[model samples]
Each structure stands twice: as C-alpha cells, then as structure tokens.
Target: MKFSRRASANWKGTGADGSGSISTQTGALDKAPYSTKARFEDGKGTNPEELVGAAHAGCFTMKLSFVIAEMGFTPGNIDTKAKVTFEDGKITNIHLDLSATVDGMSEEDFQKAAKDAKENCPISVLLNTDITMDAKLV
Candidate 1:
C-alpha cells in the first residue's frame, strides 16, 4: 500500500530577511512567522518538517498503545517525542522517545510490545529517516 501528500512553498527575500508561504495540495497554506529568521522564514506558522515530527510522534504513540492492548492491558497514557535531526545538509536520523503507562502490565511485556510497534508501524516504514526509539514502561 502507498499514500502520498504534495506540498509546495514559495519563498521571497533573502535568508535572515526573507519569508515564504507553504501550502499543501490539500488546500492548506501556512505562513511562516516573519518575526523570526529561520529556514522556512516567511509567515507565521510551523514548517513541514516540524509537522512531520508531530505526526510521527502521535502515530507511534497510538501504535504502541495498540500493541499494549493486544497484550491484554490498557494504556493509561503515552508521552512521545520525535526529533528529526539534519546533518551535512540532509536528514540523518529520527529519534523517538516514548513513555507509556499501562494498567496491569510488566515492564518486560511493554518493552516487547514497544519493539514490535517501532518495527511494524506504518510511518516508520514510510519515512526514510533512521529511527532510534526509547520506550520505557512507567
């Protein structure tokens, strides 16, 4: 199975003094905040890379929760953070940290389920970024 999203951005001015507008094919045009000098500096919002990080974190958390449920435990909460680090002008890695609280599960079981989720989740497969996952049951 395959899915794709298309987005385009138009930039005006120079770095540290320029701005841009990024819009997706879905009809969402986001302006980068002009007050700050950034890579996507143009309007008053976030960049696509930031949005991708958000989606990765949310998706991984939900996938982890589902894996835990399959082991007969309900997840109380999942706190996930994903960082996309760029190195040498290219995305080098996507690091993920997930803390999960579940009812009626041992740390060992949670670890196993987390490993499964990291490997089996759709986003992990779709993204070309290297993944580093830190899953702890608390």
Candidate 2:
C-alpha cells in the first residue's frame, strides 16, 4: 500500500529578509510562520530541519516498538530525539538519541531492535546523510 501527505509553503520577498508560512493538509499547521531568521538564528516559528527531526524521531520510535514486538518482547515506553545537523547549506548528519523501556528484554536485544529501526525507518531511508544513534535500555 502507498500513502501520500501534503504540506505547502508560501514565501515572499528575498531570501534573507523574506518570510513564509507553512501549511499541512491536515491543518496541523495552518500558515505557521517560518523565516531565515528562524532557520539560522534565534527567532520565533519553526524550520525545516526541526520538522525533519520531529518526523525522524517519531518514525524511529514507532519502528522500534514494532521491532521489539516482532522480537517477542513487549515494548513499554520509547522516547527518541533526532538532531539534524545542517551545515554549509546541506544536511550533514542526523543523530537519534533514544531511551526505551521494554519488558523482559536485555540491553543487547534492545540495541539490536533500535539499530534495526534506525536503519529501516522511512525517514531514515529518505535522508541522504549520516545517521547515528545512541540507544539506551532504561
């Protein structure tokens, strides 16, 4: 099966001084503000890298949950944070920091599951950059 999602952006004026708003098909973001300042400096609103990080973290966590279940372990709680490193006008790296609690699962098994998730998550596959992960069974 295949699925599609949509988001739109509208920008006006020049690159450095222009401002934009992003909107999603679900209305989760209805013309939300974004700008160069928000991306490069301390400013209000959100940026593409931040959005990518959120998506990556969410996808990896969900994938890990399924992987744990497939490995005969019950997943309790999983938390992941993705840090997307954007440098020199390119996305350089993405690092996932994960902490998970699984029932009757050893640290080695948890690490294996997390590694699988990090490598196979949809967003991870889509990104063309270095992906590193730190997974801890807690």
Q: Which is the leading candidate under lDDT?
A: 2
Q: What is the lDDT of candidate 2?
A: 0.94
Instruction: Write model 1 residue lDDT over 85-118, tens digit each, in one string.
Output: 8668666788898888887899899889988888
Clashing residue pairs in candidate 1 are 19-42, 20-42, 31-43, 31-44, 32-43, 32-44, 33-43, 33-44
**For candidate 2, lDDT tens digit of each residue in 1-138?**
999999999999999999999999999999999999999999999999999999999999998999999999998899899999999999999999999899799999998899999999899999999999889899
Q: What is the model-wide C-alpha lDDT for candidate 1?
A: 0.77
TM-score of each: 0.74, 0.97
Model 1 scores worst on lDDT over the 10 consecutive residues at: 32-41
How big is the positional error of residue 103 in model 2, measured in Å on the Cα after superposition?
Answer: 1.2
